[model samples]
Target: MAFEYAPAPESRSIVDIKPSYGLFIDGEFVDGHGSAFKSINPATEETLAEIAEADAADVDKAVKAARRAFRTWSRMPGKERSKYLYRIARIIQERSRELAVLESIDNGKPIKESRDVDVPIVAAHFFYYAGWADKLEYAGLGANPQPLGVAGQVIPWNFPLLMLAWKVAPALACGNTVVLKPAETTPLTALLFAEICQQADLPAGVVNIVTGAGDTGQAVVSHPDVDKVAFTGSTGVGKAIARAIAGSDKKATLELGGKAANIVFDDAAIDQAVEGIVGGIFFNQGHVCCAGSRLLVQESVADEVMAKLKRRMGTLRVGDPLDKNTDIGAINSAEQLARIRALAEIGEDEGAERWAPPCELPSAGFWFPPTVFTGVSQAHRIARDEVFGPVLSVLTFRTPSEAIEKANNTPYGLSAGVWTEKGSRILHMANELRAGVVWANTFNKFDPASPFGGYKESGYGREGGRQGLSAYLKAGA
Candidate 1:
């Protein structure tokens, strides 16, 4: 008999989402010049709130506001800025539960993840960067690294608030004012963050939240007075941003897409490697840029790993995002769900053996079951392309050299995993892997103190730790 779990849904009442939200500019909420758009709850396909869209004019106003605030913010003592950052961190902790619930409702990630992982890390990032706000001289950039002027930032929807924390915390810590555009589908948490900025008594215009789609993002990126640009999204857009600022003086840091490999050796702990593989590809419904979507296993142990992996996947609970027992939740949007479905079909068309555990999906809401494709080859589209969903492609390698060659064949170099008990092998693989971050016995782990970025199509520039601060600072200052 299968084990049954009682539903323990988290309460959403704590998050007092407004009926409509406006652009957050210069410490105020005001109407936008562009048309309004509705923010939907992916889990239930309900309209959560109407959001104001920032047009070119609105983005310019925000950029001008940030530019004006840069004069005072950049000139203020670093220690004073530290106080405000600390206050924001404290407030985030105080209201973490509300933020987590709101994140689940809007973003369709599990409540447990939003509660335990996302919100806590968001606060930790602020705390970590707060310490550096007063100590830039020791960052090894130079004697007195100076702030880049106003920064224009855009974040993706997959990990909405967390991505915002990654961009906003260090930029503020380094004394630059910002105009940030949150993804249109998941804008509530960022708007709430705007309120937190006000609650912390941060200076007017220091951090502005502009809500919109692609055109607004382009406006923010191409704005003349914006001195810096930071974006986390698709590699195609990252290229566009690079092109937009190619001849300009604007500094850019882009964290984009990936097709990471998770390699399991015959000597590895089978149970541990299976769990790592599941988490690597299924976490956040595989929306992560550095998700380990490709599985390369030694032929000697591939059968054991696949059998255990299929068993583990059979037990995954996919349903309401608010349910504490849910292991997986709804996909973020209809468009993303379509993309995942299309890719899964392509995997079948390419002669890959597809398998999904017997699971009943909700009648409503966007969702895809945890899926795996076997007998996939390096030449297959499923193996080469990023499905960006809860789909894993399995391939076998007979030797370590073959594994290394297969992993490095991808254009993306964001992250990869090596599973084995041998320390020397781990070290050797870490060195040989072309990924920006290589994990041993673990995957999808992140810390505010560790630097994270990628290479090639995955984009460039680090986002955490001391190196991250440099992205917002003028060189040789």
Candidate 2:
């Protein structure tokens, strides 16, 4: 008999979400001129709050505010700036539980992920960048590196506050004032961050937020005064942003989508490999750009890996995002759920054998069971395309060379994983993988001090560490 867990939902009372939210510009919540959109709880499909949409006019106001703040913020001593960052980081830690709960409610991610992975990393990003504010001269970009005038940032909903941290912390550390836009579906944490900025006594206009959808993002991307743009989302939008700034002088960095291959060699530790594979595809309901959606197993061990994978997947609990025992949560939105379903159908039609763990889904919310498709070939749509959901495609390879070839065949070069006990082969594979970030024997791990990004269509420019700092700085004053 399967074990059952009693429902352990995190209390939502800690976060006092306002009934309606407005755009945060120049350290104030200003009413937006555009129509309001409702933010829903993906777990229950209930409206959580009405969020003000920022149209082009509001985008203009935010950019101007950031540009104005840049003059003063960039002139402040790095030590002073560092203090503000430290304060922001402290505030995030102080209210970590509240932010985690809000994030889970807004993004449909499991509360465990929001509490453990997202919030902690969000605070670490600020803390990591805080130390760099005064020591950037040693960052190999020459002495007295100057700040870009203003940075315009846009983040995705998968890890809302974390992505905001990935963009905002580094920009501020480099002395660049910012105008950040959170994903339309998940804007609460970013707004709450504006409150954190206030608590830190961060100067007005130094960090502005304009909440909205694509149009608002386009306005920020196309704004003439935004010195740099940092975006994390779909490849289609990343390309559009690149085209919009083709002839202009605005610097940009994009951390986009991926179809990463999790290669499992015959000699890998089978149990650990199983755990890694499950974590790679099922974590955060698989709403991850670098999700190991394609599982490549060496032919010698393919059957063993598949059997173990299936059993492990079957044990995953799926349901409420707030449930402490839930392994997989609701899909972020209805549209995203539909996209995942369509792609999964294509996988089935293409002759791949599809299997999902027997799991009951919440009737009202957007949900997809943890699924795996076997007999997936390189040409299979499910293998080639990023499902961006808790769906895994299993493909078999005969040799290490074949694994590398299959892994690099895709247009995405964001991230990849290798599972093997042979140290030499692991190093060899690491050197050959074209991904910007490669993991050996593990998957989906991230750190604030480590630089992360991708090559090719997975998007460009780094988002952390000393390299991340350079994205917002000039060579010399």
Candidate 3:
């Protein structure tokens, strides 16, 4: 007999989400010229709050504010900036519970993930960049690298607050001011972060949050005053931003889409690989840009691995983002759910075998069962396209070279995983893989100190570590 678990829901009362939120520009909350939209909780389809949408004019206002603040912010001593970054990190830690709860409510991610993974890493990023703020002279860029005045940054919805940290922390540490736009679906946490900036007494215009859809983001990217542009989203949008800034002098770094391959060798421990596979594709409901959606198992161990993976998938609890025990949460929005469903149907129509564990989902929310498609071929759209949900496609490879060939066949080279106990095999596979970050025995792991980005369509430039600081600074200044 199996033991049934009771729902362990995190309380939402801790986060005081206002009835409506306005744009955060020049250290104050103000109304936007664009129309407002309601932020809905994906888990219940409940309207959470009214969010102000920023238009082109509002984005220009933000850029102007950042440009104005850049004069003083750039001149401020790095030691002073370090103090502010450190304070922000501490405050993120202090209010972590509130932020975690709010993140789950607004973003439809599991509470445990928001609490343990997202919020903690968000704070770590701030802390890591804070240390570098005063010591950038040794960053190896130059003896005196200078700030690239106002940055225009746009982050995606998948990892809302965390992505903001990836863009904002390093920019601020390098003495650049920024106007950031969080994704339309998940703008709440970024708005709350603006409050944290105020609490840290970060100077006016040092960081601005504009809430809106694509038009506002375009405005920020095309603004004459923004000296730098940083974006994390779909590959299509990344390309658009690249084109928009092509003839200009703006520095840009884009972290885009991925269809990572997780290769499992026959010599690998099947049980351990099963867990890693689950975490790789199912963590955050497979919304991760580097999710190991493609599983390349050695033919000898394919059956055993699939059996184990299926059994593990059966144990995943799906429902209620606020539930501590839930492994799979709601899709971030209705449109995203439609995309997932459409791709899944295409997989079926293309003759791939689809299987989902017996799991009951919430009736009202946007949800998808954890799905696995076996008999998937390289030509199948499901194998090539990013499902961006809790979906996995399984394929088989006989030899190490074949595994490498299959893995590198995709347009994306963001990340990949190799599972094996042999140290030499791991090193050899790592060298051959085209991915930017290759894990020997793990997947979906990230650290603030390590640099991350991708090759090919996965987008260019790094986002973390010392290398990331260069994107926000002028060389040899």
Candidate number with the higher lDDT (2 or 3): 3
**lDDT on C-alpha atoms for all candidate structures:** 0.95, 0.93, 0.95
Question: Per-residue CA lDDT of candidate 1, range 1-477, in tens?
Answer: 689999999998898989999999999999999999999999999999999999999999998899889999988999999889999999999999999999999999999999999999999999999999989998888888999999999999999999999999999999999999999999999999999999999999999999999999999999999999999999999999999999999999999999999999999999999999999999999999999999999999999999999999999999999999999999999999999999999999989999999999999999999999998999999899888999999999998899999999999999999999999999999999988899999999999999999988999999999999989987555
Alpha-carbon RMSD of each model: 0.7, 0.8, 0.7
| Counted clashes in each candidate structure | 0, 0, 0
Clashing pairs in 2: none
Candidate 2 Cα errors over 4 Å, as ranges: none
Across 1-477, the per-residue lDDT of candidate 2 in tens digits comes to 688899999999999989999999999999999999999999899999999999998999998899889899999999999999999999999999999999999999989999999999999999999999999898888888999889999999898999999999989998999999999999999999999999998999999999999999999999999999999999999999999999999999999999999999999999999999999999999999999999999999888888888888889999888888888999999999999999999999999999998888889989999999988888889988888999999988998899999999999999999999899998999899999999999999999878999999999999888889889999984
What is the clash count of model 1?
Answer: 0
Whole-structure CA lDDT of model 1:
0.95
Model 3, 237-286: lDDT tens per residue?
Answer: 99999999999999999999999999999999889899999999999999
Model 3 CA lDDT for position 120: 99
